[model samples]
Target: MEAKELEAEILRLVREMAPHLLDLLGVGPITAAQVLVSWSHPGRFRSEAAFASFAGVSPIPASSGLTNRHRINRSGYRQLNRALHTVTLIRTRLDPATKIYVARRMAEGKTSRDAQRCLKRTICRQIFKILEPPNRTRAASLTDHANQLDAI
Candidate 1:
């Protein structure tokens, strides 16, 4: 298939899999697909922090002297990281909320790079929440159904 056709197919697949993810600011079909590929399954990540770590968006301590600072993590799944970076770039340029967040971070003394890192971390958390499996276990669902039967 042609590139445009392939992108269209991806869009269709993404819509079927997780249409809600596309609602997030700056998340296009390509980026959403990358996320799904990296995530692989609902329970792949134990927590948002784990997903952030996988994406290399979790900050690593790089404190020096009395500075008490962190640095951008330079390792993890590079393709996922690149996908996140692309979303971050698009948001920074076009998303009003992201622009305000970055400005606020800058006003608080963080460098532009630092602000972007923070945004990426936030985005990672957001994506994790959207993609994570529902917390209700099978037993919980069964219990709920039992309760409903009793009520009926």
Candidate 2:
């Protein structure tokens, strides 16, 4: 079929660009390609948080009264968010580490949706690290920089 052929071509291209993305538990070739396209260049994002915000995986504070909770961000690149959501869904069902993480979060009183949001944020961070060029500042340094900015 033509669709199968196209998918194969896409997989080949994605493999040439960032094969490691496919090694990730929930990422298929299409999802990898989507990530590659969206994260077009190194240094495009100042920090992993910035990348996460762009992907709409950043948590927004929604705590009120006695409940401390965060909500999913409703802005940014929806296509990318959908890709991440697809990855999150796959991982939640099939990835052992992700299962453990979700269980741990649930044990800590987070709802299923909250656990998934956390996982998406974590995945965004991982993808950012992999996509970042080696010459750029690593996430720890970026986090420190963000912290310093927060202090100012």
Provide the TM-score for each candidate, comma-separated. Answer: 0.86, 0.86
Predicted candidate 1, C-alpha RMSD: 5.6
User: Which 10-residue span in candidate 2 carries the lowest summed lDDT?
Assistant: 133-142
Prediction 2 global C-alpha lDDT: 0.90
* Residue pairs clashing, model 1: none
Candidate 2 residue pairs in backbone clash: none
lDDT of each: 0.89, 0.90
Best by lDDT: 2
lDDT of 1 by residue, 1-152 (tens): 59999999999999999999999988999999999999986656667888899999899999888888888999999999999999999999998988999999999999998998899999998898788756845466567767889999
